[model samples]
Each structure stands twice: as C-alpha cells, then as structure tokens.
Target: MASAHHSRKPSGRASLPRRTTKGPLDAVDDPSLASSRHSPLPQPPQDEASGSTAQQSANPQPSIQHAQQPSVQVGEPIKEERELSFLFDTSIYHPLSQLEVPGPFRKPFLPPPTNETSVARSLEQLDALLSQCEFLRAAHLAGSILTSGTVRPTDSKTVFRLLAVRYSCLELSGNLLLAAQEAKALEDLSSAFYYDDPNVDKAEDDEVLQPHRVPHHIMPFSLRLQALRLQSIGFSDPRRGVSTLYDTAFECREHLSTPSTTPEQRVLWTERLHEVSIWVVNALIEMGDLDCAARTLETIKPGNSEHRALWTSRMILVRIKMGDMAKAHKLMKDSEFTPEDKLALESLLAVADGRYKEASEALSKSEAKADPSMTALVKQNLAVAYLYQGEVPKAKSLLEELINDGHSFQTLTINLATIYDLTSDRSRDLKMSMISQIAGLQKDQGQSRAFVNADFKM
Candidate 1:
C-alpha cells in the first residue's frame, strides 16, 4: 500500500484512499480545506474588501468588537470621529496665530512745557483776576494749570500759592466742604516740602554770623499756616482760625526782621503780617473778646491812611459793642471813614441809643446801592427798629418778607412774638402761636436757647 501511495502521483488525476485512525469520524473527507489549499482562499468579495479598507483608513484605530461588526451598522463611532476632527481643525489648533499681542504701556498724552516767563505771565493774569474779584474764573484757571502737571517741582511754591487763593475763593463762595478739602491738600503739600523735626532745635546760636544767609523757610511755613487757618474757618472753629492767623502774623514779623531779607521781600512780608493781624483782631471782636481784640489792634501800627481808617472802624465797633458810646463817637469822628462805612456806624450808634427813627433813616439811605447780603442785614435792622418804635404792622411785614425769603426762621419767629407781645389783647392768640413757632424753630435748629441772644447791630 505504501508503494501504491507513492506510485499514485504519477497519474494526471489520481484518487487516494482514506485510512481510519480512530472511532468516530476520522474517515470523513475535508473537501473544503482541500479546495482552500488549491485556490487562493476565495478572496473576500471585491466590493466588501474595498469597503473595509476605506473604513479602516477613515478611523486608524479599530477595536476588536468594531472590526467584528459590519461597517454599515457601526455608524456612531465614525460620526463622532468626523465631528471631533472638525472641532479640532476649527478652534483648538494654532489658536494664538489669529490674536494680536499688546505692546508695553505708555502715557496717552503729555502736558505742555512750563517756562519761567509763561508761569510769571499766568501768575500776573491770576492776580489781575483776583483783584477784579473774578474768583471763579481764577480758580478754574489755577485748577487747570495745577492738574496739567507742567510746573517744575522746584518751582512749586507759586502753584501752592495759587492753590491757596483757590481755596480762599471756594471759602468766599460758600463751598466750605470743598474749601476744607483744598486746604488739607495745601497743608499736605507744604508739609512735604518744608516740615522739620519739632524735637530738633532750629534756633541759631550765632545769629550775627548768619545775618547774610537767605532765610528759605518762611514761604512754606507761611503757606502751611494759612492752610491751617482756612481749614479751621471752614470747620467753623473761629478761635482756632484766629490763633493760626496770629501764628502766621508772628512768623511774618520775624521773617521781615531777618537781616538777609531783600527790601522787596521785607515789604511783602510786612504787608502779609498786617493783613493777618487785622484778621485776628476781627475774629476776636466777632467772638466778643473785646479786650483781646483791642490788644491785637494796638500791636499793629497803621502805615497808611486806608489802614488807619480800618483800624479806627474796628476800634469804634468794639467800643460800641462794649457800650462806650462816647469813645465810639470820638473814634468815628477822628477816623476818615468812607461815606458808606460812616453811615453804617451812625446807624449802629442810633440803634444802640434807642433812636429807632434815626437808625431806620440811616439804614434806608444806605440800602440804595448795597449787595444782597448787606440789603438783608439792613432790612433785618430796619425791622428791629420798627418793632421797637411801636410800628407793629411795618415790623410784621418785614419779618414776613424775611421768612418768605428763607432767612432764619428762629429769628423771624422771635421778632414776631416780641411784636405781638407789645401789641393789644386782640393778638394774644397770635403771640402764643408765634411763641410756639419760635420754640419749634429753635428745636429744629438745635439751639439750646429759645431766642438768640446775639446783638444784631452789625
């Protein structure tokens, strides 16, 4: 059989007999295996093979389960892969290429240059404006220049002075809160430039040897003192304001006496001291410290006719308040007062001496060309005169006008009550009503007294 098995291949087509090795189906023929070996394994249908190749190219990563599944049925993974590719191509890839990077920070604008001539011209203009009492315009101009940042640091004294003037203007304009803020800024700037250690002794031991040395400390000190004075006034602390003015006056006197000071500088400081002394005296008189006001006035020797007139006027007013009518009259006679001031003083004297008709005539004569504040004051004094002279109707008309014009309700109510009390029993109810109104007004004003005890002569 082995020889026959070998010899069977010699024929063109030969049949081989199968041998049974074991029990069950070992003799069965495997015709499919034989055909697989003879042919090329019946290459998968051409279209199906090409589809599989294309699906694999679309998604390089193929899972075993995915490979086993048919391509048409496995649609979710292919859609997801296409969407992810689209998003990556749109936003995530090369993101920075489309943006613009910013450069370093720089100032948007620069201020104009300030030269000495320009600064002087501006200061001259400011002075002219101040002299003309164009305070708002001056303040606006100064503020613009200050905020422009064009002034040199070494030449900041002029700017500070302008700022001081601006604060004064604000105070005069009745913007007390804004004035206080500006005063604080001036104080800070002065301190930054000129503050010295208080614990250190600044007194010179050999004053004669340094007589020729220029005193550089006066300007900044003056500015700081003025700022403090303005701040105190704005806060309604008149005593503190007066004290600060006194300090400034003393400092100016000392600076004026410095042997190294130029003639021009001496004149400037002397005038400043005089002005500050006048303010001190005025503040003392306002506080009813008559003795102090007199003492302060005596310290200032008048150097000009105008100053003499001012001094005389203040002294006369003080004497009038102290009930020294003879001395007040003597001073008024001796003083060369302007016609308006003379009229005001005469009216005050008449009011003090119970000459209501004379006082009313003087006030009316003076009211022809007065400012609004002065007019109000004249009206108030005239009403008081009428009330005292048994002219209840005229007093009532003036008081009602004042109340309608939003003057002090407490004052008007008190005056009305006084007038009603002096009248007949026909106005007894009206008197009670006026008294009640006075009480309410006082309560609203937070005044401790029912009637203001201040003398209204001025």
Candidate 2:
C-alpha cells in the first residue's frame, strides 16, 4: 500500500539485458551509440599538418572552430557524435556489480596477478617496477596492488603515487577526462585528512575536502556518477557548486579509458561500473525516462540464476511500466523464485486491476519483516494498497510511520503530500525543489492547476 504517487503502473515486469563486456558502459561511455542516429565527421585534429607541410604553409592559420574541435554548435546534430564518444569502451574489467552471476564466478577475468611470497615483497616489487613504465602502466600496477588485496591503510601513499604518474600521462596527452576518472578511483580507494585525530582543529577553517580545492583521489568517480544522473534527467545545467564534480567525471573517464582497454584491466573496473549503473537508474527515474532507463539495464546480462533473478526483478519494474503482465511472468518462469517473491510480484501486478486486497495479502505473507528499512518500504507499499482499497486510515497510518522513520528523500514524501492535500505535520524549511516537484505531480494528477518551478498551469 504505497502512496499513489509512489505506486507502480500495471505493466508486467521488464526483461533487462545481460551483463556482457559490451553492456551499458558501452552505451553510457558513448550515448550516441544508444540511438539509431548518425553524426557528421569529427573536426580536424590540431596536429593534422606540421610546419613543413604545404597545407600548413598555405593556410598559415587554423580556424577558431578547428582550434576548438568539438565546438557546441547551437543547432548542429552533434548529439549522436558526442554520445558515441561518451560511450567509448574503457576496456577495463567488465564490471559485475549490476548483475550477480548464478553460480559463484570466482574466475579472475583480469590477468591474474603474479603470485607473491609475502605482502612486503609485493609492495617492494610494485615500487621497483614504478620508475620503468608509463602512467597507465603505473595505474595498471596499482590495480595489481589492489588485486593482491594487501595494500593496507598504510600503503595509501603508494597507491596515490601510482595514480599521480598515470594522470600525469593523460594530462600530457590532453586527455583530461580519463585523468579525472583515475584520480577519483585513487581518492575513493584511499582518502586522507579524515576526522580522526585530536589537536587537528577539524573545524571549517581547517576543513580539507573544500569546494575550491579537492584532494585528487576522492573527486572523480563521485562527480562522474553525479553528472551521469543529471544528464539522464535532461538537466543541461546543474547548480553552481557541482562544477568540480562535472570536471572530475569528465576527466576520470578520459584518465581511465586507455588503461582499461586491455582485457585484464576491464575485469578490475567492474565494481565501480556497477556503482555507476545504480546511480544512472536513479537519475533516469527522476527525469521520468522509463524506457531509457530500461535501455541502460540492457547491459546487465542474466547468464546464471542469481544474475537472472536480480535483473528480472529490476526489469519487473520496467514491465510494470510497460504494462505487459504476460511477458513479465514469462521472464520469471525459469527464475526459480520463492512463493513469497512470486506473491509480492503478483500483488504488484494486481495493482493494475485495482485489486488492493490480493496484492496486500501477497506482500504480507512474505518475509518482509526482517530488515527495518525494508520494513519501512513495505509499509509504504501497504499504504498504497490501503489507499487503493479505499481504506484511508490504514493507508494514512503506514504513511505516517514512514515519515517518522525518516525516508523523506523519495516518492514516499511526494506521493503522501499529494494525497493529503495538507498533512497534519509539516516539514520545517522544506526544499523549494522538493515542494516544486510535488506541485508538478499534483497538477499531472489533475489535483492542482499551480506550477512549481515554472509558471505553466494546466
């Protein structure tokens, strides 16, 4: 019984694609590939002609647009070209975070690391190899260190040095994007200036991770994820403070792209890629592009049981949106799911037929009482069920319970406020963004004629 605003459409579960090396990252890294669109040729390269060449001698001048190769022409169809370039393969680890393999996937997809006799020896070997290779090799060496899994809280400097060298290479080559991605991974895997010591004056005056300046290792991946989310929802301009995040994401992609192209490197990159997918889905939903969200899910291959169920459940939401119950059920036939899972899914489908009782009964019979956060989610759904059954008090109780538990960041807040018209308890200093969002949903539901951010009224 979730609130009406948070409820699902009557469509059956969606069937998402499997997780192959060529999945969403391929699409995400280059969005142009996602479409059936085409693009004009790339602008000329800066070094196309040198001083001794006749062409260079005659021209004596490279046009401004040539100087700025990928200029943002107002009406030109650069979208597809940009998209394709964006989705270019990193050739790193084919990430496994999005979909679980049915059987245990213990195989090292990456080139197995050279076995070391001891942790200290592995560190020594990594250090010795450092001065002999390029930045990517250095980054690759860092991966080897991680693959060894012994680079402890103490080896932070070693990891940082490796990434610094790798980023330096990208900077030299004018590939800032890839540099940013690698820098981010370095930051996440090892961050410093944590709020742990005494006599450190950890207040705002001495705060480390400030906006104008950011320690390299932490900025990149988070910003990439944030930018992807913003782009998913069609927000061309994110607010002011997020510029660093944008730069980091753009740079990180470039920094990591070359090194990750090797088969072994792709294997190591999976965990971070999975994280990116989850964030992308969230952003897509906010932008209300359900089908595009489904498109992104195409990368999650369901080659085995665990993977099948995980992806099936995700697609089930899509099918619900698509309103294809038969296909949804068909997708789950071989999934070997439990009776409770089936019931919850069926009840989810029943929401379309306006059968609130059956759906609620199905969910209630399942074991959703174990985890507190999950329990809160179920309660939200139950609230929707109650509302559907025309049981106002029951639904209201569940909604109130959710608010008390403090999950005001989702549709949970938006839907309830829409239904109540006015709630007994009001949020103090509510965000204009959230309020404006609720107002839009209200208008869409034919409940209000007022606009939120824009003044357009229906």
Candidate 3:
C-alpha cells in the first residue's frame, strides 16, 4: 500500500493554456500578444514597468527592494540598459561523461557535431534523446549548443528558449543540483536588463507601456516557473515558488488590465492568472501550510465551469488534509460538481475516513472517470485502497500493470518496490528486473520525472 506521503491527489489534470503560435519564435515576433502559458519558448513582451525582480518579489532582498529605475524625460535618450553578461558565459558548458550517469542507464555515446548546423540539429537531437530516455545525452547536447557561440546574445529570445531547454534537460535527467546552479546564470529574470526598450523615453505615460505594445518578457512563463521551483528546492527556501507564483499572477493581472490588449490575449491572460493563483495554493499546500493554502484558494475567482471545478476540488482536498472532514463535506455538498467530480470527491472523503472498500467502489464507477489524463492517478489510488483492504496480491498486480502500461512514476515505482518487499524474499531481484524494464521503455515526452536509483529503494 502507498503511505500517506505517497497517496495520489486528484489534481484534475490542470494544464496551462495552449499556445496559439507555432513556436516561441512566432510569439516573439508578435509583440502585441502575450504567449500562452504552456508555450515552450520565451513569452513575448509583457509590460516592462510591471515586471517584478525575482529576488525582490519572491523574498524582498533589501538591495533589490531599494533599487530604482532611471529617471527619464519625454525626449531624453534612454541610455542603453546594462547588458546581461551571463548570456555570453561559456563556463556554463561542460562535457557529458558517461561515468557521471547512473551505471545501469549508461549507453554508448557520440559527441554532437561542432558546426553551423550543430545548434539547430542538436535541438532536434535533444528532442529525440529525451523521447528515447537518453536524458544525459540530451543534457550534454543542450550545454554544447548553449556555449557554441552560434546563438547570439543580441538574439535574446533564442537564448532564453535554449536556456529553458537546457534547464529542462538537467532537471529531467535527475541533475537538480546542476540545474539550480546553472539557473543562477540567468540572474534576476525580472530585471530591466531583459526588457530593453528604446521607445520607453518617447512614451509620455504608463499608458504607452501597456502589455499589448512592444517589449514583452524575455523569459517565457515556463522558464520563469522552472527557475523559481529550482530556487526553492535548491536553496531549501520553501516560500520562493509561492512568491514567484504570486508574481506571475500579478503579471497576468497587468496584462488583463491593459485596455489595448486584444480580446483573445485578455482571455489567455485571465486563464493564466487563475492557473497561477491555483499554483500558489498548491505550493503552499506542499509546504504544509494548509491554512494559507485555504485562504489563498478563497481569493481566486474562477472564470468558468472548468476553473470552478478545479477550485472546488482543491479546496476539498486541503480541508481533508487539515483533518476537517466536516468542512470538506460541507464544501463538497454546497458545490454543484459534475457527477464524475462529485463521485471522485466522495471517494477521496471515504479514503480519508479509512473506508478503503467504499473508496475503491466509488472509484470503480465509469461515471467517476472523465479526465483521460487523470485515469492513471485514479487507478493508482484504487490500488492503494485495495492494499488497505488487505488485498495485497491485487494491489501488487495493479501496480505491475501500471508499470507495464508505461506509467512508472516515481511514487508508483516505490510503492511497487515496497510491495515486492512484502511479497518476496528476493525483493532486490524484483526491483532490479523492474528497473531494467523501465530503463528500456522510451518516454513519449518530458511529463514523467527522470528515473533515479533511489526510486527503487536501492
């Protein structure tokens, strides 16, 4: 059975808004629109005045808090903003050694080509490597491209996009420490340095500084979020991610407030605001501050049925986590959840109250399974309920099936390993066999966390 720490929550499979543009480059070329939150490339220009420094906004460091923008007259020339030096740093690149990779996962390697085609070709190679679960190779190739001098510092959009890819590769390869350290090279993402605007002095007022105009954020939404997450985990500062989420929410608000903002952009910004707000609550909950999470959840206004469903679901989970079953029940009862959602909530409540059989039965209903992305989560939870009901063999078989079906998430793998310990004296062999199978399986995308030795309890 999965322990309380490992229990799966009904996330409702929340996702950022889809990009309308083909790629980050397309978003960059269009200055009037903000890129969708889910875009892999750097977001287009946001309001420069509204951009909040990561350190100041996240933690209120005194130096950054007291920093001031240059005072400018209507026609005064805007002195060139300080150049972002890290964009040119070559030391960030490092050779990828097979010895650095975990022994079981290592394979034969080839150094990526060093030529004009390297950066473009390496990006394709990076995608292919990640799909093949060759994360180390991808990480190395990304580093090589970053330092190859093919990507110019003047081309901030391209640089930012590649940085995001490099950061993602390091993170997905189980190199969180390196990822965090490497992220430092980005410096303060919200600094004026990233928002170079030659027209700023020509603007008579902040109205001209609206989000719909030129000069959007240089860093994409995903990279900014990733940077904060890494900072929180790498620095052991729990509040950093929460703070960053709030900054994102604030930025979204700024975009929504601009009168010139397109109807479509406004809709995207509003959706992003709601998503970031939910992320804040989730971060707080993960930090074990359920009271703060609940309070934060109360302030987010859902724009539609889908968002309302997400808010309602998250609130109930937080209340249950706080051991306030009556509050959770009341919240669930008061809301008009879809039949599927209501059934899922009832199952959650049942599990919390130790009624494993009831929870299992509720989750079994076809009406309770709606979101395809959430199916694996539901099945995993059902397996845990079976274990709690003393159906050990059933639980084991269910978890094994999940792995075989290409869903060897870390928590599921650990639970399976735990089951192996209970069912056999040769748990190590079973774990080794499972690891081999998992290592051989190709991942479809970056959604799954990278495999680590510790996940098998080795």
Give the per-residue lDDT digits (tens) of candidate 2, residues 315-372.
6656666676776667656556555456656667667567788867765764263255
Full ranking by lDDT:
3, 1, 2
Q: How far is candidate 2 from the true structure (C-alpha RMSD, Å)?
A: 25.6
Better of 1 and 2 by lDDT: 1
Across residues 1-458, which tens digit of lDDT does each residue of candidate 3 receive? 11223222212223333323221111122334343332221112111111111101211110000011111112112245333335545665555555544456666554644655645676677777666656666677667666665655456555665666666666555566787777665544554444435446565675556434433454555556667766676667778666656655555655555555666766566455544555566567668888877776766534345446555666676687789999989988888877776776787788789898998898777225557766666677677778878999998998899888888765678788988988899999999899777766643433333455666776
Listed per candidate, the RMSD to the true structure in angstroms reads 47.0, 25.6, 13.5
- For model 3, give the 10-residue run with minimal summed lDDT: 61-70
> Pick by lDDT: which candidate is best?
3
Q: Write down the worst ten-residue block by lDDT for model 2.
A: 49-58
TM-score each candidate. 0.45, 0.38, 0.71
**Residue 82 Cα positional deviation in candidate 2, in Å, after optimal superposition:** 25
Q: Quote model 1's TM-score.
A: 0.45
Q: Taking the tens digit of each residue's C-alpha lDDT, what string does model 1 give over 114-228?
A: 5433766766766666664444445555655554444443354455565556555543333446655445333322221232222133356655445533223324433454466
Please rank every candidate by TM-score, starting with the best: 3, 1, 2
Candidate 3, 363: how far from true, in Å?
A: 2.8
Cα-lDDT of candidate 2: 0.39
